[model samples]
Target: MQSQNELRNLLQRIDHKSYPAYKDTRGSYDFGNYVLSIDHVQGDPFAAPSKVSVHVRGGAAKFPADLYRMKCRRLAVCDYLLRQFGQELERVSFKAKGSGKSGLLAVSRPGQEVLERTACQMDEAKGDLVLRFEVGFPANGRTVNARELEKIFFTFLPECVSHSLFYKALDEKAVYRAADLAEDQQYIRDHLKEQGLVAFVADASILPRESGVSGRPMKDAVKFTAPESMKVSFALPHAGKIQGMGIKKGITLIVGGGYHGKSTLLKALELGVYNHIAGDGREYVITDDTAMKIRAEDGRSIKKVDISMFINDLPNGKDTSAFRTEDASGSTSQAANVVEAMEAGAETFLIDEDTSATNFMIRDELMQRVVNREDEPITPFIDRIRELYEQYGISTILVAGSSGSYFHVADCIVQMNRYKPQEITAFAKEEADRFPLPEVKPPKQAAPTFERAVRPDRAFKEDARMKLKTMGRDGISINRDTIDVRYVEQLADTEQLAALAYFLKYAEIHVFNGKRTLRESVSLLMQYVEEHGLAAVTESSYVPCGLAMPRAQEIFACINRYRRISL
Candidate 1:
């Protein structure tokens, strides 16, 4: 490694040279406290910024062992550190002056949810904590402004590393608090199965957001309070005794009038699969980690899936057991989504009627009479929800504003009136008893073996590589094929979508074999992730900082949505 002073001398020599002179700086420099590695240099100042990383020795960083002792706590600490470093970068960004994005600095910005990201990583056993980010190399109209870049490297970056990476320089109480909160969150998850709960929403949690456009908590909004009958208490290590509503593992229905917060509550449950940062509101709201938000995705392609449990007997006589379609109806797509969720090992389903197919969700008495059972092909979710829970142990939390057909099958019902939830299971059951539910057919099949093979579509099999990129959080572009995930409601970030693309790239090259099932292939890939890290998916020598780890559910969702995957 070159000494910092030697780097300064090189920058002085390269001053006023062509922009390509910056490439000479792409290597490791030994600063006093940390090692700076410039992994990739950008040729143009306006292009994507140069990739860089800082490695701080454990002896100098001085973080506690317990902070990274467990995988969960390590993720929490890493997230917190990334936020801190992001703030520091913003503080010093563009301090040095030049043209065309010169002297700009940035790291991956996080949102309300706390997800594992490659922006920050700590390996105590390896004796280093690394943080990766991007920086705009200083340039003045296609000429190198090496002195300005030198100031950023020797001055601004040192301050960021000192304040953000070193635990001693940070607020000790806040750091420990973040780590402890992770433990408490993990405690809730560890006990949920034993307590027969699929989700928990802490009392006084602010469930409403500031607006449809913002994820921040609403100011002066009504704080959520659970009905006394449904309130459950837990003794957390840090927060002590806390009371909340425990949603048991079974079929649950959320019913209410329009604009009465039914969808709001379900929306909270939808994102509860992730741990949130402090002051984000709904921090205590935790759902089954494997919970998936199911919605109707019309026109999406479905490659070989067994959706017969909810959909069968198509008029076209297309086999429902191994269903395939390039353009699926809403009902067919919804059924395929549920089946795909099951194949991904989702333990719970979170559905909102607004995004679901009407015919797939319920079939009313009048509709059943008008459309005879023989003519109808779809079984509807209302008839088979009970079996989903009782036979398969899959829990469903559904939001419905216009229908009461779900009341008969629901083990618990919660009414959201004016932004407040009240237990109404008994009352709803009484109403349903007065008008008995009509008989419906049982599930046509048992639990699936979940063996779906993935082969490239015939048109693309001959191509050597795919041009894959994430289209924000809504879709991924693989070659010319588009995998729309706009209705996969649980996807929270574009970073996660990017990671999914990388995972698919990695799988296409290594994991997928002729015999391995989709489930088996994902399991093997997950093992690699557990052993290595998300950056490993890039298959690069340098660690990338842009990717945020996605749950296996989203990975399955990615493959399921890709149009180029053949049966």
Candidate 2:
């Protein structure tokens, strides 16, 4: 370990030298308040910023163990502190300048969703908290601007760390409140299954987004209110005696006219797996952690997913039992999505009519009568929605605008009228009785087999040990072959997509064998994640600030969409 003065002296010694001189600063320094570690130095200021970390331990930061005792609460605190640190960095960032990206300071900025990310992590048992970020080392073209760099390491960073990481210098009440909210959020999650509910939307919760492009809540949007019939209450550990609309564990239908809150409410439920920031208005809006937002994904590749239960008896004699498709139609793609999600252990499915294939969703009586059962190979979701709930114990919360066919199968129906939800199960049931649902033949299989002999293409393995990157928030590039996940709607951030990319790479290197099933492999992959955190997925064991923990469901989605996946 080097002292802060020693670092200052070394920087002064290397002043006005070539850019390579900055590499000497890549080491640990004890700076009284925190130990700063320069993990990796960029070759040039124009390149990506250097990887850096700051460590605070031994009661130096003053965050309590009790507050971070639970993993959820720990993540909440980390998210809060990371944002705080980012704000502090904004104050001093680029204050000292040189050439290219010189003197720039940044961290992985968090969004509305509170995901467990690599930006910051704390081990309460060891009293160790580490914040990882990036810095653009000061340089004038190819020459080292060590004095400017010195200001960053010795001055700006210390002030930022002191203000954000330490409990004494921070907003104590806000910190505790964040921790408390996480506890309450976690409590609701744990109790949802016990309460026979798949999801809950808190009263006065804002479901509408600011715009199509933004995830932030719409300003002064109509608050959600549950009808008396659907209203249920939960006494959370921290926030006592809260009331909300409890979506029971069965088939739920969100029905309304255009521009109503049907899809908006479903959107809230789609992201309900994560805990929101206090003022995000969807704080208490939570769904089953295993919930998946499934939709039709045309042109997606499928490898040996048994979509037989949903779509069988193909005209071309292709096997639906172990289905394989390079370019699937909308109906077949949606079927694959459902099976893949179920394989990922999804207990609840959130489907929007806008995104789903109409034929896959339902067949009207007129169409059914004209087409006949023998000619039709696909069994629309309407037929299996009830059996799926009763036999398999899987639940569905579908947003339907065009069809009331789902009303016959739905256990609970909530009609969104002008952005307010009113329980209309009785009304829907009466209306549905007058209009009888079409008759359908059930599938032969009880449940689709998720097990498959999976491996990477032989050519891919020889060419590259690992080559992958997240394509923004939409897809992933694996050995130049892309896995399109644009239709995997619940993907919250690009950081989570990056985590999925690494997870797939990790799975290929560590977990995947010729024999392990998709479910088994992903289970093993997620188990490793649970034990070691997202940092373990980095092949080199280097912690990266860019990763945010993705649910096992998204991991399945990534793999299912991979073009190179072979059986």
Candidate 3:
């Protein structure tokens, strides 16, 4: 139960050999006596918060684990001082404090904006916590005032709380105490208790500017490795914020109700894609090996497109007189855009399918082709995107409505239900078995009694037929005492039928077929009769009062069953 103040005092009491002071052009201190030195605490003599440097007594001596412990202890002291006294520590510096270790831990206050940047490291051996600060230096060897250094360090050191310094210092030692903010494991368990999810705060560190650059130019590979996995919520706002789903590759879907910030999140990702170089303001730790941007061809001005002629008709009208057509129309341009992005060496593709032309993407004929594998257009394009990620190496992030055929093909589903102070939850079917929601059980049958019942002839047939006709006209169709038509109409195609079936089974809706349920099945059948020019079938089958025999017979069966069940 040692307080941070006690911890700092204990850490500073560790052994240190003293040395002598050497006066310079400006005022100087006896830093040579100490293993660490406080150098230039602040830019100006009047600035608050001190900037300190740890100068190894002989530049050749090493401190290895002791240096690590010292760094952690110092961080804890700074955090404790800032929190307790409202004074900030501007920066800390250390280099090769250990005999053979290679690295420096330089902590500074760059700005509040630095907190938003995600820090990742590739080599733990070379990893160090870097802090960038804006400071002024003397033109020559002019001395910086001690008061100013102290003021600057005290003023800004509080910002380091985001680094979780106090607990990390305790982590340096093997001590299990009541932590104000629990370790990642405890934090995860707490979140699981509250929201049925366990999110870990992987590794949070500071990014080094020099480490990622190759020579003077930025390297093509934007590599980042985190020491641990970060736990993120599933219901947070996705706009311009990085909500880590912890997914590495393959198709990831960002789904949610409209106006939930899916598009905004995609835009943020787009910005990252274009500005992925190290030290860039919008750089992100893209550990996925490679990434690329994908967008529909809505307003694009294509100069030329190379496409095969066999799969489609050539434009024959005046529009073609001005430009060459790829598939008889400009509607299929979105597919062409994806193809081009792939050809351009995109390892990851981002697609928003709403902008894709209906004729090319979702037409019944085209859908059938995609479903049957007859002529894979969009399906082949999607399949190739996956194949490239798996075989040739490519990944895709596709954004579309929650209700679409894409769900069938998506490897991961990230639904952004509502915007708030929460994080988005991403579900991977392969990693978890939340797929195909459990089926709804039938209504519990009433315990049987020892009574025999009989029904009258033609009981309630006319009333049932009239009810079925009325429901059918209003777009409700019922079959087998279950709702079918309304849900079926909501479906885009048969592929999404499984989801609807899940709804029927679990949602307690009626099921007519093995699992198919329609609210107004008979009515839908009647409407189908009318649409298909089968009015004569209805007229010829009606015995009286404009009632068709087949329709009447179906109604009689349903009504009789209802009566028998009621009895």
Candidate 4:
């Protein structure tokens, strides 16, 4: 077994590329030279500290750099094992946080599922555990001291591994041994079948061909480079930890309990698209030239923006004026930012639920009408993105928790849970029939509970408690219960305030708007209604009697007018 210093010395010998140069605030160049940061540390109380998370800088290229590191890791590990346990029947146990400590781990074995001849144990090892993948060794029951074992393990898979070693893990079946074309096709088909994914090699596959820039143009699509089934960590320091699974083209449902790396994965996908390198670890192999990133704009201080002014900048303005909102240009600006990325040559459209919601729901009905009319607000944006891929050959990748809306629109689905990602059939009833959704009972609204059995006498204080549950996909619901005066908060933004106001209208007309009453807010609205010379029309839009005074109408009449829309 070698010492940590010896391992570092060996790692320092590996070749690396010029570090990526970064421009500082003062415009100074910083090279992308590989820097070996401490990934994790393990030390025996009686021995030297074991440091992991080392990487050999391969080069300036994105995914290859990490791959190079992995290669160096393999070399280090193999070398260490060869030197320390050469021909020795010693049991080697590798452990991860959650993935059991010891098992019939996969080594450089020929079979996909090979079990080494040894009883595997997953107990908590004393030293730090930061080895690449898993480890398997012949068992000898000989107990090596912690210091020697740490030294040997650290010798191989040095954090400072090199790029030349990064082997892009490829499908073995993709390798063609025969010269026959039919054999090659059969090989590829068998590979796909074994991988459990649909494989088609058309003169023009819908995916590769559809993503072209001019052939069949897809609307509102996204492009990710070198999409992999499992999550790949794509940044330095963190190195090659699994981040998020990358899907080629389709709706990826990144769903899980709260804070389970769903949004992190989505953001990583966006960053990879924008930079062509891994944002943190996950990288994309973009085949096309364009990628777009779309997100929501929460700032609402801007009272007004000319919608027509921005709409005029579209490739062909067909009058989307009816869907204009307080932040029309801002909304359009968000969409346009993505569109500009596409126009400039982005094939992929990276958008989240929030941005899509704000952009699409600005004028839901009118936008839907535009989409139906072939003048898409969001969906057409998607269609055009697909057109860029399909017509001109562009690719798309969209992420959403509620992918039910995007199933028909996407070509595939990358199902992700926590950090683990797996590819599944985009359409239902495909080979993915094994991934059955767990049946969950629909969330029921609990009976109303009063804040206090008796009313409080304080006029300023409120004892009103409301428990609301918003329905979620597959019987999941978000329940919110609070006694605070949330409804009284000032309008944070037009969209949020508007949504809250609409919700309040169902409860009581005399809702709070900041510290003032709705009447005070109505006065401001009255001013806008008058300023726009829409007093008659806007008045009728809210109240049918043309009454200037605020009064509650019958619930039935209000329900009838609105047709009982629910969240």
Clashes of each: 0, 0, 59, 76
> Against the correct fold, how does model 2 do in TM-score?
0.98
Better of 1 and 4 by lDDT: 1
Worst 10 residues of 3 by lDDT: 113-122
**Error in Å for residue 239 of model 3:** 24
TM-score for candidate 3: 0.30
Error of 4 at 177 (Å): 34
lDDT of 3 at 103: 16
Instruction: Quote each prediction's TM-score.
Output: 0.97, 0.98, 0.30, 0.28
Comparing candidate 1 with candidate 4, which one achieves the higher TM-score? 1
Worst 10 residues of 2 by lDDT: 456-465
Cα lDDT for residue 533, model 2? 74
Best by TM-score: 2
> In model 1, which regions exceed 4 Å deviation?
124-127, 456-466
Select the stronger candidate by TM-score from 1 and 2.
Answer: 2
* Per-residue lDDT of candidate 2, residues 272-330 (tens digit): 99999888889999999999998888888888878888888788888998888799999
Q: Which one wins by TM-score: 2 or 4?
A: 2
Residue-wise lDDT of candidate 4 within 1-567, one digit each (tens)? 234444334334321211111000111111123222332222212222222222223232122222213322222222222222211212333321111121122222111111111111011211111112223211112211223333333433322222122223222222111112222222332333233222121211111112322223134323222235343332222222213223444333444444444454454433221111111122222112124445444322111122331233344554433222333344554543443333233444556664554444232334455554334333224323334455544455555564343444456665544434445544443533454322222222221111111111122123222222212111111123211212111111122222222333323323222343322333444454334422232222221211111112111111111211220
Which ten residues in a row are the worst by lDDT in model 4? Answer: 19-28
